[model samples]
Target: MKSHYSDAPKAQPILRHTLSVLVDNEPGVLARVVGLFSGRGYNIESLTVSETEHEQHVSRITIVTAGTDQVIEQIRHQLERLVPVHRVTDLTVQGESIERELALVKVAGKGEARVEALRLASAFGARTLDATVTSFVFELTGSSEEIERFLRLMGEVGLVEVSRTGIAAMARGAETI
Candidate 1:
């Protein structure tokens, strides 16, 4: 006999979601929002929050997560129900948006290796922030994929460390979130 669960519908594909939340810029507001995710056992891949309107005392939180469509919808609903949250926009589904991340990549090498690193950095449009005979610190900003690719190349050479400034996303149109 067939197993009972075999007849169940297929699972939805896991997809990347970028959620933008507008909230009151108040103490403990961020903690409460993050608690909701941790309490629910959801994973947050990237989070960037900052006050966008100083006079209005409103902040924008951008979170990148991976989940199915249903789970994403649930997250949006829960965020809306929070007292401090004024709006929740799923930039992934809303419309075209600009998403970018900044990274400070440190590579240590000398001679030919250092030369190659500098060449590659120039090719990728990375700017050299600090440099010495042995190590170089480069600042790069671009899509996540581009940053990853650049890091991989640096690794092949002599990647020492990397500091990434999570993701910052905003809708492209004139509409405010």
Candidate 2:
């Protein structure tokens, strides 16, 4: 008899994943879904839910979380077992997915900061949602990384407030979830 304990495999790196869940548009469904994550000690980075199919009474919940491959698979399986969940698609694992988030940024500045802010906003393709003498509210829709960079630059200029819509993702091509 021999022991091979020293040959254990390396631990998998934690990776970010986006899960799109199709669920019934009814009460407590969202709560249950969230509870599952909380109870299992899973951390949700971003979450967005809305009734996508009004006539069908169905909603789409997009959740971004970080976990190992095994943990992500387990979460997906558990979600599928829930009564109200119709489907759980891991957009990260799915090939060629599109992920986007919208953010509203407000900056108040009097001098050069204002000019720089406007220039950066133009470069980032952020539209001027509202503008006043002292402040401007810019609307930006892009990947989370892009939004973060925009916010960081704005912070250096004259960032006042920010409101963000969590990540909304879908598989590219003709697939529907």
Q: Which candidate number maximizes lDDT?
A: 1
Minimal lDDT window, size 10, model 1? 168-177
lDDT of 1: 0.96
Give Cα-based local distance difference scores for all models.
0.96, 0.96
Task: Give TM per candidate.
Answer: 0.95, 0.96
Cand. 2 TM to true fold: 0.96
Tens digits of per-residue lDDT, candidate 1, 23-114, equal 99999999999999999989999999999999999999999999999999999999999999999999999989999999999999999999
The clash numbers for all candidates, in the given order, read: 0, 0
Residue pairs with backbone overlap in model 2 = none
Error of 2 at 120 (Å): 0.7
lDDT of 2 by residue, 1-177 (tens): 666876889899999999999999999999999999999999999999999999999999999999999999999999999999999999888887999999999999978988999999999999999999999999999999999999999999999999999999999898575
RMSD of each: 1.7, 1.9
